[model samples]
Every structure is written in structure tokens, then in C-alpha cells.
Target: MTKLETAFAPVAPAVDLDAYFARIGYDGPREPTLAVLRAIHQKHPDAIPFENIDVLLGRPISLDPAAIDAKLIGAGRGGYCYEQNGLLKRVLAALGFQVEGRMARVLWMAPAGAPPRPRSHMVLAVRVPGDDAAWLADVGFGGCVLTAPLALFSDDVQATPNGDFRILPIDELGGERQVQADLSGRWSPTYQVASGAWADVDYEQANFYTYAHPSSHFTFSLTAGRTTPTARYALKNNRLTHRDATGALVDQRDLSAAELEAVLRDVIGLPVEPDWRPLLEKIVAWGSAA
Candidate 1:
């Protein structure tokens, strides 16, 4: 093992190669190279969706590596940032890539001039082999996730299967940056990232606030996203929104409980247990009441 591996050997979850490869439908190279990084970035999100099912079900979302593997990789369940990014970290590390833990403030949904949002969102800073600069990679953003890795440098438009993406420098002096998605000639800010070496406790605290806080939207509503080469789709509460390859919002509609179940099972390819459907009924009823 390398020095980095020796240091992380204890904390990193042992990845089940068979299971993870199957989950992402990727059977290609796992070298610590840019090509592998981009391929994994594209395929991983296409397979494991960005979802908050546990939070919506009023259950505590576990950030423990083993628990994440059991729920996401083993059982094929999806998760929010803390869980989803956590899994990606392990997989990349197990594949021999140097992955750093970082946190970002979610500014996309924030109101202008509002107090700065917490650095709650987690991201991976990767050191791909044969590359001079590190790369920013994430698979946990439920609304707009990058289907390709972006260079850490700023302002250049990066291409992804989902859309044209970029991370523009917001405060060059302060090293603050924002990720943007190009949608029909409009650049939509996804989130702002600041410089910080995020620690494990930071992620735990963020997960607590996002998953357990009564005021958090994840606690009361559902948010799920899936990406494909042809389209990207999101489920927010009862609303299902679809965007085509060009980043044009193609479809938006409310889903009935039965329809929601079908989307979960078919569109997202989640194996929704029979009993889970009843809980979904409650969720739909609760949404209507809300």
C-alpha cells in the first residue's frame, strides 16, 4: 500500500469491486487516470441516483462508511450529498485514486444578499494520474450533478453528457468559486465552493442538519435525480422535471402516488420493495396535506 493508502486504510470502507462495478455498469479500467475518472463520473450518477429517501421517511441518514455501502452499494438505494459523495470517495480511493474531502456552501437556492450559506455540501478533490492539476468531482447534487469531472481551474466551460458545465471564480482573491450549468444560453449557478480541508465532523454535522432538522426540506419532502446520456430528470416532492441533452427543460408535471411508484421503480431503476409503496402513499398524502 502507498503512504496515502496506509493512512486511510482504516477509515476507508473496503469497496466490493463486484458490487460497485455492477452498480455503475462499468467494466472498464480503474486506473488512477483522467480517462477512468471521467468514465466513472459519467457512469456512477447514471446508476446510483441522488435521493433522500431516508430523510423523507423520517429516519436518520447514516454517514458511516459501512452503512453507506449497505444502503447504497449493496441494496441499490440512493442517497443525498453526505451519503452519495461518501460512497464515491471510498470507491475512488479503493480504485487507487487520491481523493480529498472538501465542503462547499450551497448558494444556488439562496436569495441574493442573504447571509452566506453553510459549507454543508461535500465534494471530492481528486488527484488523477497523468494530470498536473487536481479535479473537482461530485455525484451527490440532486438537482444538477456533473456527468464529467471539471478541472479545478476556473472560468472554462466543461462539457458533460448532462450539459455544458463550468466553475466560475466568484472571489478570485478569496479562492471562492461557483459551479454553473448552461441551460439554453443561460448560466445557472448550482453552488458556491470555498477553500477548506473539510474534516469528518464537518460532514456529520451537515448531515445532521440536512437530514434531521425539522425545517430542512429533506425532512418533509422528497428530492431525487437521475442522469442519462439522453436526458436528466429530477423528482421534487410530487413534481417530476425532465431536461434534454441540450439542458432545455422538456417536461414538468405532478405525479400521483402510483405514478411516483412507477418512476421510482422504472425510471430510476430502484427496486422499491412492496411495503415501501405504502409509505410512499403516506408521503404523497403528507405532501398533499402540506
Candidate 2:
């Protein structure tokens, strides 16, 4: 078997590549660049959950393509960017797209007009046929990420059911790229991209830090998320918040352990293992104490 196939060979819940494609609403021949992005986004808020369950359980996050495939495709789990986007790079390459794995420093909106800080994030640069340039596609970020690939230079408005988004060039970092969204006209910073090339091993080390570091948010919160056509659901620590299409706060609640697990399985569609319960309890207790 090829390296890519072997990597995903152990994927459980059986990916059913055809069914998975159908699940994502794609029924056409592969477009290489477009198909991979669409599948990830459509499957994303469904298949891979946005959760930090593994970290709270003391499990190491693996950046291996096969390992990620097993966790996400086999076990029906969701992961953060390193795991989500890393595996996506492999899938795109396997499908014959011109794929480059790139890293980004996250510079989201801060409280006091401080400069955007760097957080380890990953995205893909895909070159498509009949197109002179590549596009930026990200399906891994929990919230406020793109559902479709955007042209690199054009300032076109790509409208999602939720809101409008645009990609613009950042000259401060020597022609680096930044993705901005209409956060009520505030133009919030989502992520910063550059022309740097990255490899699987590079992401492996970064994933280790985010999952294991005391300062990383994953170490403290039990979070899971998925995006819907009209709203976004996220479980952060003990509070569950739902945001509507106009970026309005729709609902919020505190969940018990059983409720959390049910949401993980039923709402996010991820398979919950028996061991995850104890971790969930610990997270709940931690939240209650804090």
C-alpha cells in the first residue's frame, strides 16, 4: 500500500469514502482543490469535532497522518488545527492536488488594541488546474473559519449563511496574508499566513506544545464545537454558547457530565469512548471549582 493509504488504513468507523463524499453533499468527479476543501468543511462541523477531550485525559496528541485518520475517521473524533489541518494536507496530496502545508500565527482581536499575538495554527495552500493562482482553505478552526476556499488576491465577498468574509494582504509582515471577517464592521483578525513551507514533523512538535503546555487553553478547558447553517455551537469548560447568523448570542447553558457526552455523540457525531467519562467529570469539577 502507498504511504498515504497505509496511514489511513486503520481508520475506524470505516470512512466509506463514497458515503463520506455523499454525506458532504458532493456528488461530482474530484476537482482536487475544491473537493478536498468542501468535504472537510461539510464533514468538519460533523465528523471531526472541535474538542480538547484528549488533553484533559492526559492523552498525547499525535500529528501522524495515519494516527489522525484513525482518530478522526476511525473513531469519530474531532481535533484542533494541528491534527485537523495536518491530516487534510495528506488527503489533498493523495488526491493529486498541489498542496502545501503552511503554518500561521493567530492574531485574533485582543482586549486593548494590542498587537495580534502568535498562536500556532495550520492551513493549506492549494493550486488548482485552469487557475493561475492558489487559494487559502481552512476547515479546522472551531469558529469563524471559512467554509469555502477564497482567491488569494481578489477582495471578493464570500458570503456564508452566517456572515460575509474576505481575505486581504498584510503588508506589515512583508506581504503576509490575513483573513478578516465582518464582525459588525470591526474587521477582526482571524489568522496570519505567510509563504513558508511546513512538514508533518513541524506540526508534530507544535501539537505537542499546545496539548501539553500549561499555558495553552486546551489544558484547562473541555471544549467541543461544530458549525451549523444558521448557528454555531461550542462547549467551553462548563458553559455552552450558541451564536446565531447575525453574530448574536442565541443561547447559553451549563452542562452536566452526561449532558456533555450526549452532546459530543449526538450533536457533534463523534464516538465517545468509555474512558472519556472520567475526563469529563474532572473537567466539570474543575469548572465548578473555578
Candidate 3:
């Protein structure tokens, strides 16, 4: 069997491949390069949802391909990096693309001189045929996600409905990279990929830190979001912010604890059990206080 087939063969045992593809809106001939990407973008919104439901419930996040597939594709749930991007990497590889799992440190730019703090984030780099630079594909980030693959050297601004994005080299930090959108000129720091080759195990270890660390934002927030052509629906803490097509913040409403739980189940389409209602209430309470 080919490397690609072998990597994903085990995934099928745990997940129905056809059902998984249908869940993500993937329906086309298997073309590793661009077809899979377009399928994901068409079906799944750019803003996937980085949530801490499992963390709050004391369930350890699994980095295994089958486990991720079970949570996302099988159970009809959304997840953070380890679950979202990790599964995307497997799917890409199974479609014959050269995929690498990478870790990124988040650096959020602030107004008036606030410093950037590093947080753990996960993404993937894929080497497509006839392409010199690896394309960054991520379906896990809460707000900003690439709708299409980006060339490594090009600084040309790629426009998404949400914002304009570009990646440029950072010389000051010893070759660190920065990706920025029109929303902020201050570039958000993603991962610094090592020149040497990385094994899947390397990403597995990094995934552990991201999900298990107390400092990770995924540990703190039950954030979920979805992006449409004209607007964005984001559930951050107890407040939901809707940004319009013109990049204006259109609406921001704070929800009560009970209302927040209802929104999660009714609006966002996440299935919450009776036992989980209290946890959702706790998250809403924390969000209100924050």
C-alpha cells in the first residue's frame, strides 16, 4: 500500500469515510492537491470553532487520527487544533498530498502598546504537486483561517470575505514568520517550522501541550464560531459578536447562563447532554465575569 493509503487505512475502521466526507461537504473525485481543499472550504466554514468542552468535562484530548475522526466526523461535533487540524492532515495525506503537522505560537496584537503573548496553536503545511512552497491549510482556528492555500514567498494580499491576509518573513526574530490580516497590521505569529523534517510524533507531543496546558486559551474558553460570506457569528464567553460584511462590528449581546446553553444547543448545533448544562452555565458565568 502507498504511504497515503496506509496512514488513513486505520481511520476508516473508526469512521465511515463516505459519511465523514459528506459531513465535511466533500464530494468529488479524489484530487490531493486542490480538490480536497475546496471541498473543505465549501462545506466547513473558515472559522471552525476552538472549544474546551472536553477539557471542561475532564476528558483528555486525543491526537490519534481515529479518535479525532470519531469526535468530529462521526459524532457531528467541532473541536480545536488537535482534533480539527489533525484530522485534516490525515484526510489530505490519504488523498495523496504531502502533509506535515506543525505547531504555532499565537501572538495577538493589541492597541496602544500591549505586548503579544504566545499561545499554542496547531496547523498543517501541505506540499502540492507543481508548487514550490508548502500551502498552509487550517480548519481549526477560531477567527482567521485561510480559505485557500497560500504560496510561501508571495506577499500579495489574498482577500477573504472576512479580511485581507498576507504572510511575510520576519527578520528581526531570527527568521520567524508572521501572518497578518487587514483587521490588524501587527502580524499574528504562527508556528516556526524547523528546517529539518518533523515526524508525526513531534506533532503529537505538541498537541499534548496545547490541550493539556493550563495556560492555553483552549483550556480557558469555550469559543465557537462560523463565518459566512457577509458576516461572522462568534460565541466567545457569554457574549456573541456579529461582524458585518464591511468589517464593522454590528452586534454584541451578552447572554444569560441559561440562554448561553440554549444557544449552544439550538443555534450552534452542538449536542449538549443534561449533565453538561451545568458546565455550560459555569462557562457562561466565567465569561460574564471576564
Candidate 4:
């Protein structure tokens, strides 16, 4: 094992490859080729969604590979960045891909002059053997998740199943990279990736802050997102919104409490837990009072 792999070995267990494949409905090749990577990347988010229900419920988020597998795959539940990309990290490694963990500060939807956020988002740097360029494989970014891998250093626009994205140099020294997406003719920053690859400890610390910190939005809001071949779905509180592949709004509506439950279960494809109702109730009630 490589030093990075050895360092992460203890905490990272081999994912249930068969179960994961079945969950994503992916029957493609298992090689670490770009084609295989693209296929899996596209299918993962379509199957497993991005959500923060556990955080909102005041439950601790565990980064153990086994724990992530049990909750996300076994229970058919969705999770936030740490859980989503962390699980993907193992799955890709098991498939013989040279996958490394990376961190990013989210700039998506932030005010123009707001302070920089913490490095709470998790993304993957994947090196396909014999491929000269590294590919950014992230299926964790909500609302605007990447459905296909993009060349890590490329500044040109790259198209995916969901939308168009580009990674541009943000610093004069070229130490920082910014990920942007074309949202209806307007390019918007999603997150800025730090220079080096992240270690296991980095994920643990970031994951903790993302779920536990008072300033973290995950603690208070009910958010879930997923992408399909044709459209993207984003749900916040009692509102569910849908956008087309071109990043144009297709349809959006406020969902009732019962409708929220149904949408979480059916639309978002999460195996809704009974205990989540009280939290969901609070979300609906909060929205009603607003």
C-alpha cells in the first residue's frame, strides 16, 4: 500500500462492492478507467442522494467506512458531503482507482463580500492509470453535484450529465482551484479546493465541524439533493425544487408535511426513517411560521 493508503488503512474498510454496485444500479466494468469512472460517477448520485437529516436530528456523523456503508447502502439512506464522498472514496479505492481525499471551502450561494467559510466540503482526486491528468470526482455537492468526472486542472468548460463546469486557477501562485458551474448562462462558484490532498484526520475534523458546529448550516436546515440523467432535485425545508440539465428552473413548489415525507421517501429515494418525522414536522412548522 502507498503511504497515503497505509495511513488511511486502519479507519478505511473495504466496502461491500457487490452491495454498492447493486444500490447504484451500476453494472459497468470495474476497471479504474475513465469510462468506468464516468459511469459510476453518473450513477451514484442518481441512486444515493445528498442529505443532512442526521445532523439536524442532533445525531453524530461517523466517518468509519463500515458505518457509512451500513447507513447509506444498507439502510438506503442519504447523507451529507462527508458521508457521501467518504463512502465513494472507499468504493473507488476498492475498484483499483488511485483515489485521494480533498477538502474545499464552499462559495456557493454566499454573499459577494462575505468571509470565507471553513473547509467543510469533501471531494475526491482520482488518477486513472496511464491518464496524465487527475480527475475531480465529487458526488456530494448538493443541488449541483457533478455527474461526470472533470479534468482537475482544466480551465475550459466541461460538460456533464447534469450541467457544465470548469476548474480555474484562483491564486496567482496557482495554489488554489475554484470549481464553477454555468447556471443558466451565469457562471457561479461552487467551492474552492485547497492545494494538497487531505488526510484521514482532515476528514474527521472537517466532518465534525460540518455536523456539530453551531455556525454550520447543516445543523439547522433540512437539505437533500439528487441528480438524474435529465434533471436535478434540491429540497430545502418544505420547498422542493427541480432544474433541468441546462440549469434552468423547470418546476418548484412548497411541500406539505405529509408531502415532505413522501418526497423524501419517493422523490429523493431515501428510506425515510420514522424518527425523522418530528424533525420534518419542525421543518414544516418553521416554514409555515415564516
lDDT of 4: 0.89
Tell me the TM-score of model 3: 0.83
Root-mean-square deviation (CA) per prediction: 2.6, 5.1, 4.1, 2.2
Ranking by lDDT: 4, 1, 2, 3
TM-score of each: 0.91, 0.83, 0.83, 0.94
lDDT of each: 0.83, 0.71, 0.66, 0.89
Clashes of each: 0, 2, 0, 0
Q: Considering TM-score, where higher is better, how would the candidates rank from best to worst?
A: 4, 1, 2, 3
Instruction: State the TM-score for model 4.
Output: 0.94
Q: Please provide, for model 3 over 1-290, each residue's C-alpha lDDT reduced to its tens digit, 9 standing for 90 to 100.
A: 99999887543223355766777566777786565665665456532444668876778888777777777877777787667777777677767677776666565434446555543566777887675677767677664555556554566876655666677776545544566666544444444432233456676666676668887656777777666667666787778877764346788899987888777776565776789878777887788789
Better of 1 and 4 by TM-score: 4
Top candidate on lDDT is 4
Q: Write the per-residue lDDT of candidate 2 for residues 233-256, one digit (tens) a residue.
A: 777776777777756688898879
On TM-score, the leading prediction is: 4
| Residue 8 displacement (Å), model 3 | 17
Candidate 1 pairs with clashing backbones? none
